[model samples]
Target: METELLSYAFSGLLVIVFFISIALAFRFSDGHVRLRKRLKSRLIYGLPVGSMITIVTVLAVYLFLQGGIHDWDNPVVHPFRSWSYFYPTGTVASGFAHGSPSHLTSNLTTTLILAPIAEYIWGHYPDGQGGTNASRDQPWYRYPIIRACVLFPGAAFVIAVLTGAFSLGSVIGFSGVVFAFGGFAVVYYPIITVVGLLVVGVVRTILDGLVEPISFAGVTSTLPGWTSTAVQGHGLGFLIGVLLGITLLYHRNKRPRIFELFVALLIYGLTRGLWQIYRPLGGNEFVLYRALGVSVVLIGAVLVTATVVASKRPLFEGSSVTQREAGVISLVAILAFLIGPGIVTNLVIIDYHDEPADDELAVEDYIIGYDENAENPTEFVFDAPGTDETIERTSSGVYVASDQRQLWIMDTSQNQLRSTGTADIQIGGIGWRETVTAERDGLQVLGAQSVYAVELRHDDQLVTAYESNASTANIRIDNRSISFAPDIDDRFTITVEGSDGVEETASIPSVNESVEIGGIMFRASETNGTKFISAERDGTVTTVAQEE
Candidate 1:
């Protein structure tokens, strides 16, 4: 029922945008003397509306192949939906992909609102049908969007890669490029800031409750649902845009000061490269949040220094933006802003992460060499212990195998395996060396040292239930109950009954201590820089081992 409502809402929003764009396209296409042959002006009026049509069409195709409106995080679609432009498939496809409806709307509101004004400022060629006007106040390149379309992707790619490599996370969405457009418009006309702030503020207010949470301008919040602002991406794009503005818009006739330009470029490159290699921007607590602050400071400093040094000519002072033009553009953007959020809200309101289990293949279908001749088709059949003992398949293409007291979880769809509870451990806190249970409804893996659970409703997203950064020793799992000591301070027990799971934490008296409860003894100790734990059953030492 909820899915149907959401789908209808999304379709309705798209329909609205479709009609608006068509109307605007017709409006600009009309044969008024004021509109005819004014290629630059016509484009400024039409490009954003036309872009909306393109966006809607592509998103409709994405919705179809994804099987639903809320399949935002499909792995195959993710590569194309967001900008991971450093990779081969991400470069050309990033611009077309959006993760969620809110993501699309936020970026769309900014772009559609600001892009027309930017186009008019940079692209408007007044002398109709004539050749290029060298004497015009603007730069020689008439179409700013052409240059912007090229630069925005490159900027997004660079910033996303740098952030992923140096900072805490990678970025997606059109916000960064929208910031670029904003930066360009602001540089061209400072008065645009008033309108820019008002629009973003109003749009954010109306839509903040509908999408991921956002912090106000000065306050900092990293709570759940508070999406990352991607400071690095936005900063990079803004800086690049500012540089372009200085070069093209500010100094029309005089030669650019090469030294200042070099300095500005060098500072930007150096900061980004260093942030990637050795991110020192953040102090201890603010490390994850420092990228944007650093970028803002550096970009501002570079812009100031460049304006002082490289700007040989005065700022462009051609035709001032009239009140009538500003009002019209703002009105168009307001309509887009109002419509965009509804589309995003409908598309992302329902989480469709867990699909039905009707497509379950036979357990033997995934067993290797089960039907093959026992006679050697290949040289190695190397059967190991525990491999044949316990093997199970969950509905979500997850295979759980216990081999040599180690548990392995394999995703058949991606051909990836994560092994735990062995001598070799991938995560630091927990050690697993026993049979692991794979639940079907949500496909959670329960082991001695670690517990992996996926939220079926959240697109099968993997979430850690019990993980510690410190080494966890004295692991034990019995009758679907798990207990382990993490570092020197505390002990934790995880209990599972049927499909429900819960965890409880208890404090320890000292580094070396033992607890006895309900005919069971759990002890923790350390020797030779290694943690150890032992379980006692009915006054007998049942298990003793080193923490993995």
Candidate 2:
């Protein structure tokens, strides 16, 4: 009984839309095609209205099917009806569907405003001269309605049965219908709702996490994107909208059809690329995501190569941004490219060093990864020198490279002795035996010394004064090989060689510069910042300075 009523109502609605569109089309022009074009615009305007109507009408019918809108007049039989679960496929449309009069009237008001408008536009489609001026002559109505009637119920049913997901059956509404209306409009259609969602994201986050989460531009609540549940459908719908927009630019003529197809495909690919990066997926689909990512990378690479070879001036001019829109878009594009692993070259670096080949490691908050087949790297450790400074590095090998001039080597793995050499013959560090890194400049420690001294930086203005107590043996040099300062800052990491004549070797980062037994202190006679800031018994503080 309910199905019959719904079928009758739908048929009637379809008839009304068809007649109105055709009547309007004919009234506008004697030439049917010309009139159809005129009607197309109106359909564009009315599609949303029709879609809104479907929101109401479908809800009412759905209620009846669920037995909720039972023949209450004859209270003997009332049907069961209620809200449904979320289904990714059709929830947006289904959301509009409801269980009773309250639902129908609620949606119908909106439907009245949005659905009829679209249906009215369906009236305009080319038909033979002296055509019936009805659904018979309207391709717009036939194609859209036919597609919706077939696609919606059928897709929902098939998907539900196959997946054993009953939620699919519970789906309702006009979104899919409106989508169809929009699909026919421009294919690149722009929906205001999407932009609204993006704007609301910041506001929504603020309202949601009341306990103070993240803030942006003084706005205490903002989500980091990915958290939005409706993001997927909204995204897909947006893509369809844009595609419709592009389709509007398509020409049906056979002559330019091939070219138009190429342009359309290009637009689709580009848009899809944008979508993929914009909507990120997690590691579950590692293989698929990486494959797709690589494909995009290759495409972009080809474009870049072509651009380089073509030899044209950069549109930005490099001095300053010529246009604000262009500047922002360019910045966003650059950031996306960089983050997507596009800025890398074969002769390049993941950071200042090559990436590791194996699975990436999450050390603290830092994530380091290499190209798929790139070389693996050792974990990094910092190198501490003098009193307070430490240099961060990538390799475990203890080495320093301030300039390209020299490398300093501390046998970090060996506590017995620290070593250094001229980066000339053996370049010091890298040897196949224990594993080391060789650079241009390095310092050498004799036998087992307390500290392997090397010139960190020399700054002498012809006549400079350096004060020192026993604690600050501030070393000064006019021009020298190298020297080491007491590792006063971090006592734990200070590598000490032995106890006796200031000779000891320990672990990493700590420089072994000892004076007393088991202690590494300033060897320099002057109190310079290079080693330590010391005060004599008289309570006078002194410092040592270095020149670049």
Q: What is the C-alpha lDDT of each candidate?
A: 0.38, 0.29
* Model 2 TM-score, 2 decimals: 0.24
Q: Model 2 Cα RMSD, Å?
A: 25.3
Kindly list the per-residue Cα lDDT of model 2 for residues 165-284, writing each as its tens digit: 122122233333333333233122123222222333443443333322322465444444323222222223323332323333332211123333333333433432322333223211
Instruction: Using lDDT, give the best candidate's number.
Output: 1
Give the Å error, residue 462, model 1.
16
TM-score of each: 0.40, 0.24
Expressed as tens digits, the lDDT of each residue in 68-185 for candidate 1 is 2534433123333222212323333444345555666666666666655555444434222223333557554444444334433344445333222221222345554555555555
Misplaced by over 4 Å in model 2 are 1-37, 40-49, 55-132, 135-217, 229-548
Error at 503, model 2, angstroms: 56
lDDT of 2 at 337: 36
RMSD for all candidates, in order, please: 18.4, 25.3
